[model samples]
Target chain A: MNSNMKFSRKTEELVNVFQFLKKKEIEFGCTDRQKMEIDLCVEEVFMNMVRHNSTAKNKIQISVNKTADNKIIISLIDHEDHPFDITKTDDLDLEDYVEKKKSGGLGIHLIKQMMDEISFEHQRGISKITMVKNI
Target chain B: MLTIEKINDNEWKFSGRFDASQADKATKELADPSGTVTIDMAGLDYISSMGLSVLVNTYKHLNEQGFSLRLTNLNRHVRDIFKYTRLEQVFDIVDPTS
Candidate 1:
């Protein structure tokens, strides 16, 4: 199954995102745990674009598709071409994070840990983040 | 819809999805937790990064006051969120069923 959506830059659109993902759950046929992780991954990528990329003028596009080999692929596209590559983010030190009580990069860290693969592509002033999870 | 109910002066019950849109409401309800704050996560189905930040901020605030935060009745998924972030070490998580 394959589906895609375009959302405004505001965080309020998260409700719509959840609704979209909930519909995909039937087609994805993933376990409950996997569903939760997919939700997290999508939310993190979507929020990152909304929060960090303040200059983004266009709507963000998100797509979900299931591969032939039973893998779920999620893609998020930022049309504004703000290139913030999450894959290159440094590994977080849990000890230091707790000591300092910092929240930065935590979302990216979770996305990395939960998703099987995360790839970034930039071209023609568009930033696309693709994440995959094995069912 | 996220529901944050103040069960008492030190305990709050969180139910439904706690995502980015609900973070600000959670933050406002969780602000100024006086004593050892206990958050009941029994009815919480989902929590995103922004939701986690609210908990972390509350923990920091309570820790500075010579108190700490406790999370109870977390579902497996929510528990894994803490485990992945290694925040289990900082917050006292209790599983009544276990």
Candidate 2:
């Protein structure tokens, strides 16, 4: 609750959006290792949002706020009835690519593994996902 | 996060963190090593599955081209990553950097 960064975008903007978000995280003093993990994971989640909402016209709101304990909390808010929690995707055999890779499940799995905590919110016609990590 | 030093005769030494974030351009550069190439990962910190995928893909491509792919300077961390993926048997993992 110390601070926040908000962004609005359509699905098309997600392609290279991770690069920008990653740079911003670095600016906030996230360690390089944490930055790399968060950057990769955040990109995956954003990419998922875009894919799931192919016809999404609403701009997503992403906020990054610092917690009292000097941690970073990230939230992605949308207005779609996305059925899955997205944090529960199963792991993949890192060996298989073409078959398993096309599914694109690794990103979510990796995110789940890297982040300390990931949770989603769905109420009042808004879907919000927040990821927290102690930096 | 990886360091590259061009050894004489077009060989290059690679060391440091080579993860998904660091693979794209490194893959491109490694794919075309300019000549016989050697990668030294003794100082490698850690690598992701994506990193290994990149290395395996490059290895396949290089093998087809009849180009010599020299792998040396493997630290314990790098070796463990390869071992986990069973890539230890696929690519040449050498110790002697010479």
Q: Native contacts recovered by candidate 2, as a share?
A: 0.03
Error of 2 at A46 (Å): 0.5
Docking class of 2: incorrect
Fold similarity of candidate 1's chain A to the true chain A, as a TM-score: 0.94
Could you tell me how far off, in angstroms, the CA of residue A70 lies in candidate 2 after the best superposition?
Answer: 2.3
DockQ values per model = 0.81, 0.11
- Residue pairs in clash, model 2: B42-B73
Candidate 2 local lDDT, A1-135, one digit each (tens): 323344345434543455456656766778766765666566566656766876767777667766679777888777786645786565656566432323235456566667899998789778888998888
lDDT of 1 by residue, A1-135 (tens): 449899989989988998899889777788888888999899999998997787767899999999899888899999654588999989888889877878767899899899999999999989999999988
lDDT of 1 by residue, B5-43 (tens): 999999999999998899899988988877999999999
Worst ten in a row by lDDT for model 1 chain A: A77-86
Q: What is the TM-score of each candidate against the true structure?
A: 0.96, 0.56
All candidates' lDDT scores?
0.89, 0.64
